[model samples]
Target: MADETNNPDLEVNAASVSDGAYTLIIADFSDTDMAWEAYETLKSVEDGRSVEIEGVIVVRRTTEGRLEIQKATDHSTKSGLKWGVVGGIALGVIFPPSILGSAAVAGGAGAIVGKLRQRHHNHELEQKLENAITPGHSGLLALVSDPGEIKIRKALERAETIVESTLEQVEADDIKAAAKEVQGAHA
Candidate 1:
Protein backbone atom coordinates (compact mmCIF):
# COMPACT_ATOMS: atom_id res chain seq x y z
CA MET A 1 0.00 0.00 0.00
CA ALA A 2 2.90 2.30 0.80
CA ASP A 3 6.66 2.41 0.62
CA GLU A 4 8.94 4.02 3.20
CA THR A 5 11.88 6.21 2.36
CA ASN A 6 15.12 6.00 4.23
CA ASN A 7 15.62 9.72 3.81
CA PRO A 8 14.56 11.54 6.97
CA ASP A 9 13.36 14.47 4.88
CA LEU A 10 10.70 12.28 3.22
CA GLU A 11 8.17 9.66 4.30
CA VAL A 12 5.91 7.05 2.73
CA ASN A 13 2.62 8.56 1.60
CA ALA A 14 0.21 6.38 -0.40
CA ALA A 15 -0.11 3.52 -2.89
CA SER A 16 2.80 3.22 -5.27
CA VAL A 17 2.44 3.18 -9.08
CA SER A 18 -0.26 1.15 -10.81
CA ASP A 19 -0.10 -1.42 -13.58
CA GLY A 20 -3.05 -0.68 -15.88
CA ALA A 21 -2.94 3.10 -15.33
CA TYR A 22 -0.60 5.91 -14.50
CA THR A 23 -0.54 7.50 -11.05
CA LEU A 24 -0.37 11.24 -11.37
CA ILE A 25 0.39 13.20 -8.24
CA ILE A 26 0.10 16.93 -7.96
CA ALA A 27 1.53 18.54 -4.86
CA ASP A 28 1.23 22.21 -4.08
CA PHE A 29 3.86 24.18 -2.25
CA SER A 30 3.75 27.69 -0.91
CA ASP A 31 6.87 28.58 -2.82
CA THR A 32 8.42 27.53 -6.12
CA ASP A 33 11.73 26.87 -4.41
CA MET A 34 10.18 24.19 -2.28
CA ALA A 35 8.48 22.67 -5.28
CA TRP A 36 11.72 22.60 -7.21
CA GLU A 37 13.46 21.11 -4.22
CA ALA A 38 10.98 18.28 -4.15
CA TYR A 39 11.43 17.74 -7.88
CA GLU A 40 15.16 17.40 -7.44
CA THR A 41 14.68 15.07 -4.52
CA LEU A 42 12.51 12.79 -6.59
CA LYS A 43 15.07 12.64 -9.35
CA SER A 44 17.86 12.03 -6.86
CA VAL A 45 16.01 9.14 -5.32
CA GLU A 46 15.39 7.62 -8.72
CA ASP A 47 19.06 7.99 -9.54
CA GLY A 48 19.88 5.88 -6.49
CA ARG A 49 17.55 3.11 -7.78
CA SER A 50 15.20 3.52 -4.84
CA VAL A 51 12.31 4.15 -7.22
CA GLU A 52 11.29 4.72 -10.81
CA ILE A 53 9.51 7.87 -11.94
CA GLU A 54 8.21 8.29 -15.49
CA GLY A 55 8.40 12.05 -15.43
CA VAL A 56 8.44 15.09 -13.15
CA ILE A 57 7.25 18.64 -13.74
CA VAL A 58 7.21 21.79 -11.67
CA VAL A 59 4.47 24.29 -12.35
CA ARG A 60 3.89 27.64 -10.73
CA ARG A 61 1.46 30.50 -10.83
CA THR A 62 3.43 33.68 -10.99
CA THR A 63 2.57 36.65 -8.77
CA GLU A 64 0.38 37.73 -11.66
CA GLY A 65 -1.76 34.59 -11.39
CA ARG A 66 -0.64 33.06 -14.65
CA LEU A 67 0.02 29.32 -14.89
CA GLU A 68 3.54 28.60 -16.07
CA ILE A 69 5.57 25.47 -16.50
CA GLN A 70 8.65 26.28 -14.51
CA LYS A 71 10.33 22.99 -15.31
CA ALA A 72 9.46 19.93 -17.40
CA THR A 73 11.24 16.99 -18.88
CA ASP A 74 11.27 16.51 -22.65
CA HIS A 75 12.76 13.06 -22.61
CA SER A 76 9.82 11.48 -24.31
CA THR A 77 11.84 11.75 -27.51
CA LYS A 78 15.17 10.89 -25.98
CA SER A 79 14.51 8.28 -23.34
CA GLY A 80 11.06 6.95 -24.25
CA LEU A 81 7.58 8.32 -24.81
CA LYS A 82 6.66 6.84 -21.45
CA TRP A 83 9.25 9.00 -19.79
CA GLY A 84 7.38 12.22 -20.49
CA VAL A 85 3.79 11.07 -20.66
CA VAL A 86 2.75 12.26 -17.22
CA GLY A 87 4.12 15.76 -17.61
CA GLY A 88 2.61 16.07 -21.07
CA ILE A 89 -0.81 15.11 -19.76
CA ALA A 90 -0.45 17.58 -16.91
CA LEU A 91 0.39 20.49 -19.21
CA GLY A 92 -2.43 19.54 -21.54
CA VAL A 93 -4.84 19.45 -18.61
CA ILE A 94 -3.82 22.65 -16.84
CA PHE A 95 -2.81 25.06 -19.60
CA PRO A 96 -5.56 27.38 -20.72
CA PRO A 97 -6.22 27.42 -24.45
CA SER A 98 -5.47 31.09 -24.78
CA ILE A 99 -1.98 30.49 -23.55
CA LEU A 100 -1.54 27.88 -26.24
CA GLY A 101 -1.29 30.70 -28.71
CA SER A 102 0.71 33.92 -28.62
CA ALA A 103 -1.83 35.95 -26.66
CA ALA A 104 -3.64 35.38 -23.38
CA VAL A 105 -7.00 36.24 -25.02
CA ALA A 106 -7.41 38.59 -22.09
CA GLY A 107 -5.61 41.51 -20.61
CA GLY A 108 -3.11 40.23 -18.06
CA ALA A 109 -0.23 37.94 -17.18
CA GLY A 110 1.48 37.67 -20.53
CA ALA A 111 4.05 35.20 -19.23
CA ILE A 112 1.66 32.43 -18.32
CA VAL A 113 -1.83 31.17 -19.15
CA GLY A 114 -4.57 33.26 -17.48
CA LYS A 115 -7.50 30.89 -16.97
CA LEU A 116 -9.57 31.09 -20.13
CA ARG A 117 -9.74 27.44 -20.99
CA GLN A 118 -10.74 26.64 -24.60
CA ARG A 119 -11.81 23.06 -24.02
CA HIS A 120 -13.25 21.10 -21.15
CA HIS A 121 -13.23 17.58 -19.80
CA ASN A 122 -15.89 15.65 -17.92
CA HIS A 123 -13.52 14.70 -15.15
CA GLU A 124 -13.06 16.84 -12.05
CA LEU A 125 -9.32 16.92 -12.54
CA GLU A 126 -9.55 20.52 -13.70
CA GLN A 127 -11.23 21.65 -10.52
CA LYS A 128 -8.87 19.52 -8.51
CA LEU A 129 -5.94 21.28 -10.18
CA GLU A 130 -7.42 24.66 -9.38
CA ASN A 131 -7.67 23.69 -5.75
CA ALA A 132 -4.32 21.95 -5.52
CA ILE A 133 -2.26 24.91 -6.65
CA THR A 134 -4.00 28.20 -6.36
CA PRO A 135 -2.75 31.43 -7.86
CA GLY A 136 0.78 32.41 -6.94
CA HIS A 137 1.56 28.95 -5.64
CA SER A 138 3.86 26.23 -6.93
CA GLY A 139 3.18 22.59 -7.67
CA LEU A 140 5.05 19.40 -8.36
CA LEU A 141 3.50 16.96 -10.85
CA ALA A 142 4.92 13.50 -11.14
CA LEU A 143 4.13 10.11 -12.70
CA VAL A 144 5.50 7.31 -10.62
CA SER A 145 5.54 3.56 -11.05
CA ASP A 146 3.86 3.43 -7.69
CA PRO A 147 2.50 6.22 -5.55
CA GLY A 148 3.86 4.27 -2.60
CA GLU A 149 7.43 4.51 -3.85
CA ILE A 150 9.54 5.84 -1.01
CA LYS A 151 10.85 8.71 -3.12
CA ILE A 152 7.36 9.70 -4.13
CA ARG A 153 6.15 9.62 -0.55
CA LYS A 154 9.04 11.78 0.57
CA ALA A 155 8.72 14.39 -2.14
CA LEU A 156 4.96 14.69 -1.86
CA GLU A 157 5.29 15.28 1.88
CA ARG A 158 6.87 18.65 1.06
CA ALA A 159 3.68 19.88 -0.52
CA GLU A 160 1.07 21.79 1.42
CA THR A 161 -1.65 20.30 -0.73
CA ILE A 162 -1.70 17.02 -2.60
CA VAL A 163 -4.05 15.43 -5.10
CA GLU A 164 -3.75 11.95 -6.56
CA SER A 165 -5.48 10.56 -9.61
CA THR A 166 -5.23 7.46 -11.76
CA LEU A 167 -5.65 7.46 -15.53
CA GLU A 168 -5.44 4.71 -18.08
CA GLN A 169 -2.69 5.12 -20.65
CA VAL A 170 -5.24 5.74 -23.37
CA GLU A 171 -6.81 8.58 -21.41
CA ALA A 172 -3.48 10.19 -20.88
CA ASP A 173 -2.59 9.69 -24.52
CA ASP A 174 -5.79 11.41 -25.55
CA ILE A 175 -4.98 14.37 -23.39
CA LYS A 176 -1.47 14.60 -24.80
CA ALA A 177 -2.68 14.30 -28.36
CA ALA A 178 -5.25 17.02 -27.78
CA ALA A 179 -2.66 19.33 -26.37
CA LYS A 180 -0.36 18.67 -29.29
CA GLU A 181 -3.15 19.37 -31.72
CA VAL A 182 -3.80 22.68 -30.02
CA GLN A 183 -0.11 23.49 -30.09
CA GLY A 184 0.12 22.56 -33.74
CA ALA A 185 -2.78 24.80 -34.64
CA HIS A 186 -1.14 27.65 -32.84
CA ALA A 187 2.12 26.94 -34.59
Candidate 2:
Protein backbone atom coordinates (compact mmCIF):
# COMPACT_ATOMS: atom_id res chain seq x y z
CA MET A 1 0.00 0.00 0.00
CA ALA A 2 1.16 3.56 -0.74
CA ASP A 3 1.81 5.91 2.13
CA GLU A 4 -0.64 8.71 1.39
CA THR A 5 1.00 10.88 4.06
CA ASN A 6 4.22 10.84 2.06
CA ASN A 7 2.63 12.17 -1.07
CA PRO A 8 4.40 15.38 -2.05
CA ASP A 9 1.48 16.74 -4.01
CA LEU A 10 -0.83 16.31 -1.06
CA GLU A 11 1.68 17.98 1.24
CA VAL A 12 2.05 20.89 -1.17
CA ASN A 13 -1.67 21.26 -1.54
CA ALA A 14 -1.92 21.44 2.22
CA ALA A 15 0.43 24.36 2.46
CA SER A 16 -1.46 27.54 3.22
CA VAL A 17 -0.87 30.85 1.50
CA SER A 18 -1.87 33.89 3.52
CA ASP A 19 -3.31 35.42 0.38
CA GLY A 20 -4.25 33.82 -2.91
CA ALA A 21 -4.81 36.79 -5.17
CA TYR A 22 -1.70 38.52 -6.46
CA THR A 23 -0.68 40.86 -9.26
CA LEU A 24 2.78 41.09 -10.76
CA ILE A 25 3.68 44.69 -11.49
CA ILE A 26 6.74 45.44 -13.59
CA ALA A 27 7.59 49.14 -13.64
CA ASP A 28 10.48 50.43 -15.72
CA PHE A 29 12.57 53.46 -14.82
CA SER A 30 15.00 55.61 -16.74
CA ASP A 31 17.94 54.37 -14.68
CA THR A 32 18.91 51.90 -11.98
CA ASP A 33 18.87 54.59 -9.34
CA MET A 34 15.36 55.60 -10.30
CA ALA A 35 14.24 52.00 -10.11
CA TRP A 36 15.63 51.60 -6.60
CA GLU A 37 14.07 54.92 -5.58
CA ALA A 38 10.71 53.87 -6.92
CA TYR A 39 11.02 50.59 -5.08
CA GLU A 40 11.70 52.40 -1.82
CA THR A 41 8.86 54.79 -2.48
CA LEU A 42 6.47 51.98 -3.10
CA LYS A 43 7.59 50.31 0.12
CA SER A 44 7.07 53.52 2.09
CA VAL A 45 3.62 54.30 0.72
CA GLU A 46 0.71 53.64 3.09
CA ASP A 47 -1.34 51.56 0.72
CA GLY A 48 -1.04 48.22 2.44
CA ARG A 49 -4.40 48.56 4.16
CA SER A 50 -6.00 48.34 0.77
CA VAL A 51 -3.49 46.00 -0.79
CA GLU A 52 -1.21 43.30 0.56
CA ILE A 53 2.23 43.39 -1.04
CA GLU A 54 3.70 39.94 -0.93
CA GLY A 55 7.13 40.64 -2.41
CA VAL A 56 9.25 43.02 -4.49
CA ILE A 57 12.36 42.59 -6.65
CA VAL A 58 14.42 44.95 -8.78
CA VAL A 59 16.06 43.83 -12.04
CA ARG A 60 18.54 45.83 -14.04
CA ARG A 61 20.72 45.12 -17.03
CA THR A 62 24.15 46.69 -16.77
CA THR A 63 25.76 48.57 -19.67
CA GLU A 64 28.14 45.60 -19.85
CA GLY A 65 25.17 43.38 -20.69
CA ARG A 66 24.91 41.62 -17.33
CA LEU A 67 21.77 41.17 -15.25
CA GLU A 68 21.40 42.06 -11.59
CA ILE A 69 18.56 41.20 -9.22
CA GLN A 70 17.99 42.90 -5.92
CA LYS A 71 15.49 42.22 -3.16
CA ALA A 72 14.45 44.48 -0.30
CA THR A 73 16.37 44.11 2.94
CA ASP A 74 14.06 46.32 4.98
CA HIS A 75 10.61 47.54 4.06
CA SER A 76 8.60 50.35 5.71
CA THR A 77 5.09 49.67 4.47
CA LYS A 78 2.69 47.57 6.50
CA SER A 79 3.11 43.91 5.59
CA GLY A 80 5.95 45.08 3.41
CA LEU A 81 8.42 43.27 5.57
CA LYS A 82 6.16 40.28 5.91
CA TRP A 83 5.67 39.94 2.20
CA GLY A 84 9.27 40.81 1.69
CA VAL A 85 10.17 37.86 3.87
CA VAL A 86 7.97 35.61 1.81
CA GLY A 87 9.46 37.02 -1.34
CA GLY A 88 12.96 36.54 -0.03
CA ILE A 89 12.26 32.97 0.90
CA ALA A 90 10.73 32.35 -2.49
CA LEU A 91 13.70 33.92 -4.23
CA GLY A 92 16.08 31.79 -2.18
CA VAL A 93 14.43 28.79 -3.70
CA ILE A 94 14.53 30.20 -7.21
CA PHE A 95 17.91 31.94 -7.18
CA PRO A 96 20.41 30.89 -4.56
CA PRO A 97 23.35 33.13 -3.75
CA SER A 98 25.82 30.70 -5.28
CA ILE A 99 24.09 31.00 -8.62
CA LEU A 100 23.38 34.72 -8.17
CA GLY A 101 27.14 35.45 -8.17
CA SER A 102 27.55 39.18 -7.46
CA ALA A 103 23.83 39.88 -7.28
CA ALA A 104 22.55 41.01 -3.91
CA VAL A 105 20.63 38.54 -1.78
CA ALA A 106 18.36 39.12 1.20
CA GLY A 107 18.48 37.44 4.61
CA GLY A 108 16.34 34.43 5.58
CA ALA A 109 16.27 33.25 2.00
CA GLY A 110 15.96 29.47 1.87
CA ALA A 111 15.19 26.67 -0.53
CA ILE A 112 11.43 26.89 -0.36
CA VAL A 113 10.81 26.60 -4.08
CA GLY A 114 8.88 23.46 -3.35
CA LYS A 115 6.44 25.42 -1.25
CA LEU A 116 6.01 28.16 -3.86
CA ARG A 117 5.67 25.60 -6.62
CA GLN A 118 2.46 24.47 -4.97
CA ARG A 119 0.92 27.93 -5.08
CA HIS A 120 1.84 29.66 -8.34
CA HIS A 121 2.77 28.77 -11.92
CA ASN A 122 3.37 30.90 -15.05
CA HIS A 123 6.45 31.95 -17.06
CA GLU A 124 4.94 34.78 -19.06
CA LEU A 125 5.37 37.23 -16.21
CA GLU A 126 9.07 36.45 -15.98
CA GLN A 127 9.48 36.73 -19.74
CA LYS A 128 7.78 40.08 -19.73
CA LEU A 129 9.99 41.26 -16.86
CA GLU A 130 13.15 40.16 -18.67
CA ASN A 131 12.07 41.94 -21.83
CA ALA A 132 10.96 45.14 -20.09
CA ILE A 133 14.21 45.87 -18.25
CA THR A 134 16.86 46.70 -20.81
CA PRO A 135 20.43 47.90 -20.58
CA GLY A 136 20.84 51.33 -18.93
CA HIS A 137 17.27 50.93 -17.62
CA SER A 138 15.77 49.20 -14.58
CA GLY A 139 12.53 47.53 -13.66
CA LEU A 140 10.70 46.99 -10.37
CA LEU A 141 8.74 43.77 -10.09
CA ALA A 142 6.24 43.43 -7.26
CA LEU A 143 3.88 40.70 -6.11
CA VAL A 144 0.87 42.41 -4.61
CA SER A 145 -2.12 40.57 -3.22
CA ASP A 146 -5.61 42.02 -3.80
CA PRO A 147 -4.65 45.65 -4.17
CA GLY A 148 -7.00 48.57 -4.74
CA GLU A 149 -5.73 49.51 -8.18
CA ILE A 150 -6.59 53.16 -7.75
CA LYS A 151 -4.82 53.51 -4.43
CA ILE A 152 -1.72 51.69 -5.64
CA ARG A 153 -1.71 53.77 -8.79
CA LYS A 154 -1.93 56.96 -6.79
CA ALA A 155 0.91 55.85 -4.55
CA LEU A 156 3.10 55.03 -7.57
CA GLU A 157 2.13 58.32 -9.15
CA ARG A 158 3.29 60.12 -6.04
CA ALA A 159 6.60 58.31 -6.42
CA GLU A 160 6.84 59.60 -9.99
CA THR A 161 7.03 56.15 -11.54
CA ILE A 162 5.08 54.41 -14.27
CA VAL A 163 4.20 50.79 -14.88
CA GLU A 164 5.66 49.21 -17.98
CA SER A 165 3.78 45.92 -17.73
CA THR A 166 1.32 44.51 -15.24
CA LEU A 167 0.38 40.85 -15.04
CA GLU A 168 -2.32 39.76 -12.64
CA GLN A 169 -2.52 36.30 -11.06
CA VAL A 170 1.04 35.20 -11.71
CA GLU A 171 2.49 31.85 -10.66
CA ALA A 172 5.62 30.92 -8.72
CA ASP A 173 7.03 28.81 -11.55
CA ASP A 174 6.95 31.78 -13.87
CA ILE A 175 8.90 33.85 -11.38
CA LYS A 176 11.40 31.01 -10.84
CA ALA A 177 12.05 30.53 -14.55
CA ALA A 178 12.56 34.23 -15.07
CA ALA A 179 15.04 34.49 -12.22
CA LYS A 180 16.79 31.37 -13.47
CA GLU A 181 16.99 32.75 -16.99
CA VAL A 182 18.48 35.99 -15.75
CA GLN A 183 21.01 34.13 -13.60
CA GLY A 184 21.67 31.65 -16.39
CA ALA A 185 22.64 34.43 -18.78
CA HIS A 186 25.38 35.54 -16.45
CA ALA A 187 26.45 32.02 -15.52
Clashes (backbone N, CA, C under 3 Å), per candidate, total: 7, 3
Single out the weakest 10-residue window by summed lDDT for candidate 1.
104-113
Q: What Cα-based lDDT does every candidate model obtain? A: 0.55, 0.47
Candidate 2 Cα deviation (angstroms), residue 166: 7.9
- Cα lDDT tens digits for candidate 1, 1-187: 1223443433223332224476677777888889878877776677424476766777776666666666344443222333334464455555444323232221222222222123334245555455556677887777654676765776667676667766567555554454344444444
Q: Whole-model lDDT for model 2 versus the true structure?
A: 0.47
Off by over 4 Å in 2: 1-20, 70-73, 76-84, 88-105, 108-110, 114-121, 157-187
Any idea what lDDT model 1 has? 0.55
